[model samples]
Target: MGTYDYIVVGAGSAGAVVAGRLSEDPGTTVLLVEAGGKGRDLNVKIPAAFAKQFKTGLDWEYYTEPEPHLDGRRIYHPRGKMLGGCSAQNAMIYIRGNRADYDAWAAGGATGWGYDDLLPLFKRAERNSRGGDALHGGEGPLFIEDPRSPHEVSERLVDAMVEIGLPRNPDFNGPTQEGAGLYQLTQRRGQRWTTSDGYLRPARKRANLTVLTGALVTRVVLEGDRAVGVELEQGGSRVVHRAGREVVLSAGAFGTPHLLMLSGIGPADHLREHGVGVVVDNPNVGAHLMDHPMYLLNAETTAARTLAEAESPRELVAYLTRRRGLLTSNVGEAGGFFHTTDGLAGPDMQFLAGPAYFWDHGFATHDKPAIAVGCSLVGPRSRGRVRLAGSDPSTKPSVRFDYFAEPADMTAMVTAVERARELLATSAMRGLVGSELHPGAAHTTRAELEAQIRAGVEHTYHPSCTARIGSESDGVVDPTLRVHGVQGLRVADASVFPTITRGNTHAPSVVVGEKAADLLRSGVVAGGRAGQVA
Candidate 1:
């Protein structure tokens, strides 16, 4: 292929938006490279059927090297390797998280990225089902829709929260986020709306944009100090593709930083350990890994009307004909955020209720009858890292997610699970709940709860902060998202989030892509000269 004006590596969540936005200029030529094949799986399109995609060929299926806090069980992490990436396989919840999250980044030396500054970009990138306004966007390429068939159990879940004195937040992405309510989905009608469907799909019709699926980018080829192209492996053949202007790294939190490190952009010591030559001895490249840690509080439910039992002919007919019923429900229907105590600045915990049991990573195949409510620590203090398992680019990297490494994380998780149990004890949830499954009533004491939390907690799958934005002293990428020691390249995605937000990260990740695109198009890098490549 010929040299393009811009080369966007990894056609995942953030890359889709970058390619979509940059190609809109018409004059600029953009190329998007995806490692996996087309993301057109039936399970990917069906909002409720997403769990089926896990561990499939389209998924990366990464597992963290045994977390010491989780009783030495290597938690399974399923990342999409398709065109839309995780967006194609994730629970379709749409959340912007707390506004304080953005403000905190600005306070941490990342200028012009506070809540107020980033709101416009968030609005510009979304087209909500409720339409556009000061808080939401309507005409944007990304489609955000309401849940199609929200089950009655979803309402009961919210009612249980209210019965336990929690307020009802009609919109989690609205003025307030501290309450239980039905969550909006990243869907368009009954179908899933991934970044590819919202952004890249439309951009493909444009002559200026070219999307190459199943193309594994091995490294970001650097010409001395400047990144000028990418080396990709296609059908066992190595090919070098050049970029006329700049290269954008939107390969997500894990992939982007991994690619950078492979191209000799991480710590000098780690580079030598992996037998890779050091180009820019940046010590903070793959550090500061943050992810949302959570645990499930399961109870056998008396409610016969659940997706768990909806495998009947009637429900099958409903799904097959009009795509309505319990089968259409996104497992996480109703959710909430609450403070562990009064006088706190924001919510310390979040809740996600599923009408059916999720034994492993998702729903089990057997006739196990249970309902689950999961609690996730919104702001975790623990940190971890991602390192090369080998020098080979195709090899999966070792992810050490040091969950509950901090006392605050364990405290928050225990409190959240306790709150969930307390809510179920209320009359609203008592009508449906039968008996505790994981940590029963016997595990109520502080010590017992703490132990259960340490043993039972797993990832909410919101891993970020590998290449976070901040001052050069503390981050891999600067406020403008340019890599610290690398020139002509930028990293955009959840990887750039200094601290992981308090809600579903998909919407926020898209927002980052939107803002990063604007910064690159406006010719403004961290030091004022954008096109000059650092």
Candidate 2:
């Protein structure tokens, strides 16, 4: 048994930041617990080899229950199980989402969560190689860089988007997000740089900070109306670890809700049926799940130099010796945001272009080279839920995305696919690409395209909002991120997003972690002195 000023579960995307930044006060004792090992694997370090880690030991390997809207097919969700969590496993696209995303959250009852309130934190966490400005950060923990060796397909994809009438904006994390350009990566030089590499490891030497790996938390320990500790299994024993001030649950979208239910802070009737005592009876604990549904349009590239050559011995030698090669590619090398429908605050769809065959999560390979253009529905109106499978902690939760459950979502996706076809037909890709491999040339009509979508649609790996922020009537956590009916507890992760952001969620998750630390430091969320980091 152990005790600390704060116990941050999961050591993931946000939890690592919470534990690391909390211990910055020297006076505070912090404990970070993780179920996985260190995130220094070879596959994790190589950007192009990211998909190799899927369904492996480093992944949580979660699969949703058959989604009714997608022809009752189970969608695979691969969450990083190591120190950095999804941030370590993601494509590392350095996008903070459209400014309107935060404004909408603030407008929807999440006060102080507007875009302006978060921009500085986003800046403070990034160290862009291009240097800082009024909009970007120059000196920060995480490193952002340009792709070291983007293939010909990547450059042509950007050109094709522009040739099809999109602006050529160089920076997606700038004043605007509507443009075709190369994506900056969460990388330094050429290797993948995760939050664990940037934030957690640097703070490990602090005497006040403790990191426990291979620890599986059973549940949060509540005393009366407040969370005081947690029960976990480490090594061969079950143990209890107490917190002096707070127990912050950063176990991510799926794990956080699962832990809350296991701790009896979920729906009263549901807990009762599972033979557990209810502490909060909050029916909103695991509701309102969200994710971006994406369909990849693959075409055989007549031109050479795609990810098909990224794994060759020559490229590896270049990567290992000089850190410059195709291995630095994040796969989603170049793309942009665009509105398929008008009257929206920002672009509703995001294009993720990559120079690879990229199907079945990279398990499917082709004899010839190919280029993949992923049309992702970023502003999905569809919602889903997460439910407990059983009382056991080892049991995974049952999640249902219900993708395309909203007709507007399907309409937007189909339009995006049409746009993709238009981009492929452009002069920029005239002789470069030919013969669509997915949604084949045979499927042309809207109805047939929708069917093709249901048959092969995947996600951008951005799962969030299962434990969203709002009042007690509609949400599990409040504006300050503390659970509504529970005391001395808070959530700082993608799970707390009132609405999922308009782009890759890694950057926003980093901001949430930074803000969470600031809140704890100023004693605002602890309720001693309410103040903003600004």
Candidate 3:
């Protein structure tokens, strides 16, 4: 068995940051483990090639159980399986969500997690190309940049949004989030800047940090209620690694909870059903699964304004010579936040305008010139759960999003579709856009719209809140991220979010890692028992 000061179970967004931060002190030794290969694929570096990684070796490619509300359809959920996790395989959008998201968590039993408390960590971890401001940081590990060459179609869509009375806000991560604007990306000089690239890579050269790829953690090795170490499968060999300080689980929303259940730390009944002995009996371990449900509205373009034309020799040469052109696009180039109704806390609906036919999560692309807008319910009331399919570690978990189960969620989606249609019909989009290809004009009535929504609803790839941070009654982890009823174990990732953030979750996931590092470093070790961090 090997030992270390800290053992981080996933080398994704949060794990990368945690290991990198902890190893900064030469006296500390950190271990970061990943189940997938190194994130060195060309598809991971090119911002526009993110879709190509889906269902490939770099993706976990999880799917949810049939949803009753959506005609019993099983939605595809793709997560990053490589070193950088989803950051290396995502659209690279840099949005921190609305401030109210954090404040609400603070109000709802999560102490010390308010917007005011997290803003500094957000700034500290960001290296925005736009330079430092009250709301942004200029010099940090994660790089954020504007699109190198914004597609004309995306620019026109922004103008159309402004013409339709949506305010023109230059920065979504700034003071307010309610507006239409171009999305900043987690990129640098047109190349994707994944957390592994930004944080882990820098620390890999440090003698104190050890990174192991292709290591599949089977379960946490618990002694009574305290996590002593982990058992993993590396190269078809069973290996045990002990942690001297703590065992941090940054295995993401799905992986983390699945590992917990595998270690017999979840609901007692569920564990017994899977023939796994219960340890903690925490019913909330795999519950509270949440994600943003989205539907795409595609329209044919009159001119060659989409990425279809750019996938040519000329564009390829341009991209090879200088990291610019359509290749630099993050697919979902421009988007904005909007409220379906006024007087709400924040935007309930989020829109993304892509310069391609983004149907079926980009699994199938067309030769025709097209532009698509994604309408998603950012604040979904529908909650779901992740349950173990069996006790075997290799078996994928059973995920049920329970999407559209709440009638109000469908109502909001219907409004979002109408808004998307309006944006496509604007004067600015008159020449650029042609006939609607999805959910044609015939589906106008509420009943028809609802049917169409049910037929085409898909996930936004932002699954979170499975193992949330809250009080003991309804929470799995405390505010400091220490797992309830478990010693020497903590969770830091999107799963700990009390509520889903308003926009893409990439930025917030990285911020959670930065904060978690601080919490771990400053935490005081107490009398042979697990200590409190931050």
Candidate 4:
């Protein structure tokens, strides 16, 4: 194959958007390489069946090192192993995160990445069903729709939140992210609208764009310090593909840093230990890994109001015919953001209320009707890192989340559990809800709650900030997303997040892609220098 203007590795959220937008000029050729096959699994389409894809071929099924804070349990971290990546596997919630998050990035020396600067890009990428506003876009490639059929229990949860003095926010992606309401989903007519669906699929018809699935990128082909191409394996054979202009890495937080390490770019001491040659020796390449630590507060219900009741032929028929029923639910049907205390810059805690028993990250489900509230400490103080398990690209990286390593994180989680219990105990849910399931009512003391948190806390499936954009002292990528001291190379993915956003990372990941495409199209190179397009 001939060299292309750009070689985008990993056809996930960011890679899809980058390739799609770069190829729009018709003159520029873009190649998107994906390690996984096309996401054509039947479970990928049904919103309610998302958990069914877990531990299967569609999931990478990465597990963490035993968390010292969580009773030495190795938590499962399931990433998508297909074209759309986690977007095809995740609960289709569309959350843009609090504006404060981006503003903080700018304050931390991400020059062009303030909340105001990225808001337009966010609007430009979304086609919200609620229509355009100063904050939302009406006609964009990615679709954001209201839940087709929210469950009664979900409605009651929102009502219960309102009853507890939290405002009823109709849209979490609006001006204020501090309230309770139904979650908007990345769906259209009840089907999932993944990045591959919104960006890559349409661009596939263009002759300038080439998509290669099952192509596992092994390392960046570097000349001195600049990335010129990539070494990859496809059809059990290895090949080197060159880039005329640049090579973009969108292989997600874990994969991107892992690949960089394999390509001899990472912490010098660690790479030396693994016998990998040093290229740039960026110390922060795999540091600052962050994720929302969550705990579930579940309760048995008096009536069969959960999704467990919707497993019959009638509900399936209703979904197939009109796209309305439990099948349309994203599992986390309703939720909101709330401050643990007053005067916080943003919501310290976020909730995702559902009608089903969500235990062990939805790997296990109760047979009877039950309602659960997922409370997450979104602003966790604890940080983690991803390291190369070995020099070989085939070996999975060692992921250590080190959750609750900070004492403040544990305090916030305890408060989160208490708040969720309060919501479930509201009068609106009195008649519907029964006894507490996981952390029983008997465990009321702060010490007991703290103990329960230690035993039961899990990840919210939002991993980010492994390779962030920031100042020269602390960041892996610059504000323009170009790797420090490396030319013809950039990263556009969740890994580049300056900080973990307040909500789901899917929307922000897409925003990164859109902005990266714009940066590349404008011929702006690293350090704000003008450059020629290939």
Please name the candidate that would achieve the greatest lDDT relative to the true structure.
2
Q: What TM-score goes with each of the models?
A: 0.97, 0.98, 0.98, 0.98
**Predicted candidate 3: what Cα RMSD to the true structure?**
1.6
Q: What does the lDDT come to for candidate 1?
A: 0.84
Candidate 2 clash pair list: none
- lDDT score, candidate 1, position 97: 89
**Local distance difference test scores for all models:** 0.84, 0.89, 0.88, 0.88
lDDT of 2 by residue, 396-476 (tens): 988999998899999999999999999999988889887899989999999999999999999999889988999898998
lDDT of 1 by residue, 380-484 (tens): 889999888889999988898899889878877878887888888888876788888877878879889888877777778788999999777889888888888
In angstroms, give how far residue 123 of model 4 lies from its true place: 1.0
Alpha-carbon RMSD to native, per candidate: 1.5, 2.2, 1.6, 1.5
Off by more than 4 A, model 4: 527-534
Better of 1 and 2 by TM-score: 2
lDDT, residue 319, model 4: 83
- Model 1 worst lDDT run, 10 consecutive residues: 359-368
